[model samples]
Target: MSWRPQYRSSKFRHVYGKAATKENCFDGVPITRGVQDNNFCAVNPRFLAVVTECAGGGAFLVLSVHHTGKVDPHHPRVSGHRGNVLDVKWNPFDDYCIASCSEDATVKVWEIPPHGLLKNMTVALKELQGHSRRVGLIEWHPTAKNILFSTAYDYKVMIWNLDCPEQVIKNPVRTISHHTDVVLSMSFNVDASLMATTCKDRKIRLLEPRSGTLLQEANCKTHKASKVLILDNVNKLLTSGTSRWNDRQIALWDLDDLSVPLLEENLDGSSGFLFPFYDPDTHMLYLAGKGDGNIRYYEISSEKPYIHYLTEYRSNLPQKGMGVMPKRGLDVSSCEVFRFYKLVTIKALIEPLSMIVPRRSESYQEDIYPMTAGNKAALTADEWLTGIDRGPVLMSLKPGHPTGESDGECEKDQAYIRDRLIAKNGGKTDSNGVAGNGGTTVSNGQDFLLCSPPKTENELRVKFYKQQDEIRRLVDLLHQRDVRIKQLELEINNMKNSQQNSLEHF
Candidate 1:
């Protein structure tokens, strides 16, 4: 007799994907036609970057997330690459910082301005040159500051320590154990201590990234034909590729023992490459093909049948590539757990699809959202380079949770609302009414009334504008902190150099 239930029970079974309308979609973008297998789009909470087709050296467009709809034809871009931009990744800790790899055999890091680009950006914040051939993949350390990894056609993965003020890392501090062939994809463990990579040679190798030691190697029937793979949260490896019969298949493997797969399943025949995106927080794995319009999601567990099929998000238009938003970037208010930026090459559009868990109440849904990783890094580059391991700082999705950011701003906004209400009403009132010109009455001490919502549409509009202003202020504050960090770094470096010279002279 089977010990498990016939049908699986999960709160996320009812989760559905919601696509934004045309007005909400990013339009008029000549998305890159690069033949690269990597996603050409990258998004953060504040900005979105898309590799665009250019007539000259490679260029990528950066726009404020709010600047949606038809992009301005003359909008500024980061246009310094001598060849096509292959991949772009945002800094896990800093919203304004981003890194890119290109066919020019170099990697560049860029720091976006506070309000986004206003003119063509040719100067890069930091440049790294070591790859003999085109650099194709780049990923920032998950828990470390300014530690980056770049894989190139040279079949080498280089680790970069970018803690300098504003200078080039002439070469990587060192290279990881070299791959026999091109590294197709790369993923790091939670603390970035270990790295898993799938290579062109059709083999999956796990390495202690810092020491460049191959801890485990898997060579089986699945390994021979697999094209893409990633390391997930549960200490398991998930791969998607074609099978012997030319059918698309996915397999799951335990990191400890990769001699045989724990589970393997085959899907329909498709020639396009399948891109596997995993959300460690929700334990959800999404498989999207390059030329398919459907996105299939599955729940991953450590128990039997580790991978459970959730549902598919289908559309009429095929996707050229897709970008996923980080957990901190999601809209917790809407009960959204995941968001994807699908690049439609034929229509030159990037559509956003949000995965939402439906809820009756508008309040925060704690069940769907556990504490997630914040923007702050848990380890510095030096600390990580010295083999220190620490988990990412966790933050609540609830509003005003003070995840490193000051809560005083939120309190000040509440104070402002209270002052406005008090000023509007000459005296105190009750929850039943607000003291207004033949309108409503509000209580004196109450900053806001939950029972009586914004009665008039005009009042609601006022509240909306106030909220927008508050958002802008918060954004500006974040930008100010970014600039301050840069200034402080420069000062610290100068002081260090002066002290070294003084000590030598004495």
Candidate 2:
């Protein structure tokens, strides 16, 4: 059969420039499929980590990110787990430090040599053991140098401080047992002060680990375990999961109220979990999954619904795993803002797909390509452990247009929110003395006002509903405790009677 384009429109062709320009060609790393889960891919600027299942056992490959145009079978690798490794994360602050969790119910921290990728399996520098079952996820704090979090099938979350003097000989610093089921996914906010976790019980919980506070918990009515992502600004949260009708869905929630999602969109019925990547610079979010050939992206805004569908990048090859490059690692010369590393297991290929905003004018878009946080570590591991109230230093996204010029595009974007308010309120001023349309505002060579509308009856009802639910939960817990106490008392009385009878007979 002759080959033809699957898409009716040629819009996908121009997404990443020419077909050859989309993919950065490199030799594929050979891996044995079916022996391990396809969720073991991670990358730093200097190295790429992939798990390989061989006849002997599963091993982790650390390959140089720079291209040599040749594949080396004898790459530097790590093999300490008896079973397959489930997840791996490169330390955000330390390039040499990498953390991996495995099916052996343990998490291990490994350090790569300064020279380059190792040619053989190397021992881990430290092993973290606490979970009774398989550990599947591990995450490093965004700003903290040595803090790490890991979750397992045992329904436990462990927070580790690696730089502690007695860490190697002791357990994690704190253990969170709030989750009633296996935690499927987790994400930390930009400043690392808050974290969100989605679990097998179809529940999502937000936490402030430093204060031991459970910020929020809401039931997610999904068919399968879901993944939660905190948006760049930390005021919004997003989750991807399958509905009861077996349809994939993405829902956006306001951090203040989790009782209802502000927006929910149903998608295809694919079974793979969606991994979301968000770019703060352009307010773009990309969702990719296993066994899928297309990537769907959205543009987030301050308007109602919050997410606007942009477009999708389609390909014929199915992906088994995917990873994304840090924003600082992108090629700013081509106006590229995000790059995704897709793992094609069947073909044993790792493809780099770069997403760029095409422009005809030959100029560097300052607003789009503004200064971002580099790969440099702000604090040493020991220093962070001893520090107090540490906050991450992230690149602030500019508020104007991508060109950073006072053009029509910039004016339109700056006025979009103000215009929406004017339309909604019929151009009337609110009680705060700010008009919906004719008010002085804050902008670059522009004036716009933002007003907080009073809460509606619907919002009040949502809070009432949440309070009632919490009361019912607490009542049920108290009843269960009472029943257990009565049973214990009865057992104690029977034991006393038996002892008295024995003494009388003697």
Candidate 3:
């Protein structure tokens, strides 16, 4: 989770305090303490593992339990890079593994417990050396283990297979070169099938994952000084930063045709760079800036092709935390909001019956002798099958008829009446009882048999009951799996322990 304070209030001061003391000096210069740029940090689902950038040169891997936010500071700090750490990411599946990239043009993977000095510390398990220039970004493959991708200032992107330690680090699975300038940012599509990269050359390139082929390129019309480039997806791209001579604009490009952008809405409010976050789920874009310290949200729609400011978040004080010195008279860089997953308490799923039932009141005849209104309208066949309107619709069905029919007949009749009513009502009713069919009428004095299906409360309860039963069964299975895993871990630990004991005994 991105841990930004609610506001620049004193609350932030209480949460992350200033550096207490300087331990290691870089190049004879005491590394001043202060809040650094709010770069991307990855946190595990269980919140037990946190990978963050350090001020000096390397990244720190802190492991802690979820309940108590106590970090094991002694956990092996992976520190071999010559420059400041740029990014760190944890493997999605394995909580004990992490990948770190730095300005030193190197990407390294570390395994906890095995390589660290402390029994429970973290240590570097492998070093990946390929990029000759500063490594700006590193990301794990979304679906595969032992696979990772990295982008660097060397104008090259490399994909690595970390699974085989014996494999030479210099040999990457695939290497692609296209950008004339430094590759600023890179992202993978929802599936690992495609990859996108943005560069200072005012170009965004999309490549196939299996084969290093350039599929499409979109011109951002951005100047050479653009700070960040991000591919929105396979077709769309986003670039932002201080423009060469114009006010900062967050440009969106369409890959199909690069000559003209589908949309180039300017963000007049921000003086600094705009950090854009595109959510695939809602197709909404969120933009933030360091100059204004305001986070703005925009809805990206193809039809409108305009940016709508949904909301803005601002802080009262300068973002620079205590003891952290701002670089080159600039304010602390705004925290970049990256996407991450968090585990939430699973709530009991309550099946809603209304959704299952089809609405028929809209088709009801307003001119009928007795008209139904509000929630008392009889349910339709669609509603019965879906378990919607189980109570009121079923109860209202009997009022129109003199005798109650058998349960099975009631269900069948309800279905038949609903279909006929839909056909008779011309399937039309307005919000204010305005009939769309010019007139409403009944064929004869024969009592209308409008029977909605029985209430789905029992059915829903039964479903919940079944789900609960399934969950219990899964829990039992998980318990068994956990026991097996523990047993294997214990055996491995014992073997290692016995070996040590033998060495001492000899």
Candidate 4:
């Protein structure tokens, strides 16, 4: 039987209520300290798993999210890490299982009993210890159940197969050493075929998890470091970091190119790190920064200037840490498109912010509704470790909708110009004869070709100068041709005169 509380519990306070008539707001449960960005707080898709850490204790709580803002007295908690629990993640395939990274330089995998309750702090079922420094980030594979990845201050990324059972350091499935500096954030693509990492060295790299090989890398070219997030469409990546001048900016990059940002937006020069939350179904991106009271959102489309500014959610208090609930956990019936758990340190309160699409119609709009990824493992841990080429079943942005259809017809003159570029400079192919996108292949059987222009301004300038020199040389040759034509005409006239004089003498 499932665990349940016997006695009545006090109702949690709501910052804003319908009867109060002041504003629409609510407060979350009090936390020990502000949450960190490195997977500190995770809410599962089914609203079954909610994990958070306390400021004072090196422990975390697995809250019962079914009853908002209320914790069952009999509910179990997780308390194993020695130092601060920096990050925690709910397994995509298993709601009961969770992985956490800590300042103690260890990653632990914990599972809740099938009966649905842990009465006290417990040790992790599997302990992964390899990092010599604090492990700040932990992420689970989107498609695989037992596969986990962690990043630490040691500038290394380790892939773990929790099914191994043995807690040994020398037997990690794969150890990635591509980053020269500490990796700030990492994420797997929609299908889990490619993994991208943003490091403090101002570089973003894409790696193949199967072989732990570096597929491609892009220089952020900025001093400030931020996290990287893969778009739901799996074709692009959204990055938020400091600009060259030390200003905060968010950029949307095409995964194929990575050299030039498809879109770039500058924001306030605040020192807080900008955390990007992207909703694939709606193509909406929410930017929440540390130490800021406002959450800005934008609409991303395939059109030019791909990112369009939408609106911002503001409050009186700044947030120390923030957590975003999965799409499946959202109250879609109420037209809630996105939900955010904001941790405010001012009054030691956590607040819930819901982004709803205001609709006047009474009918349900499945198009606007978010169809979140279900809790089903496409591949097991053992299968992934053995190099299975399976990918996660990612939902489309506009599922059930037809692609490549236009409502109206336009002539060639009215259509926008499409640019297709190719690099002819010493291009080489891999063993598979794929030369583009640095020989990278997507799980969808599509090849990503690198067709972007020069990345840096210096490179663009050099190309421009070389083109100008070619034009100058071409003009000089044209002038020489004109001079040669004139000289040839004069010589022909002199030869004709000599021939006429010889005929008169005969």
Which candidate achieves the best TM-score against the true structure?
1
Regions of candidate 2 where Cα sits further than 4 Å from its true position = 1-24, 32-38, 166-169, 222-225, 232-234, 361-363, 377-390, 394-506
Off by over 4 Å in 3: 1-40, 47-57, 63-76, 80-82, 113-122, 222-235, 244-246, 269-271, 317-506
Query: In what order do the candidates fall by lDDT, top score first?
Result: 1, 2, 4, 3
Ranking by TM-score: 1, 2, 4, 3
lDDT of 3 by residue, 382-468 (tens): 332233322221211112232222354344433444444444466665563433443222233222233343354344334434433
N/CA/C clash count, model 2: 2
* Best of the candidates, lDDT: 1
lDDT of 1 by residue, 102-202 (tens): 99999999988645675689889999998999999999998998999999999999999999665777778779755788988888778877788888777
Better of 2 and 3 by lDDT: 2
What does candidate 2's lDDT look like per residue over 1-506, in tens digits? 99985642222224452222323533557653743333568887656787776555557777656543445665547877787787889987666678988888888888875334424644677888788998888998777668889999899888887875553524887788899998888888776667898888888889976554788998876434378888856479898887778788888888778888887788898777677778766677888866887788877766675887778888886777777777755655577778777777776777777888776655556756656654444565545445444455444223221211124323443354444445445677667645544444322223333222226534433443443343334334555776799999999999999999999999
Off-target runs (Cα >4 Å) in candidate 1 are: 1-5, 223-232, 403-506
Tens digit per residue, CA lDDT, model 4, 247-353: 88988788888877776677988988788888877777788878887778777766576776666777777876667776655554456677776666565455667
- TM-score per candidate, in order? 0.80, 0.71, 0.51, 0.68
Q: Ten residues in a row with the worst lDDT in model 2?
A: 397-406
Q: Candidate 2: deviation at residue 430, Å?
A: 79
Displacement of residue 126 (Cα, Å) in model 4 is 1.1
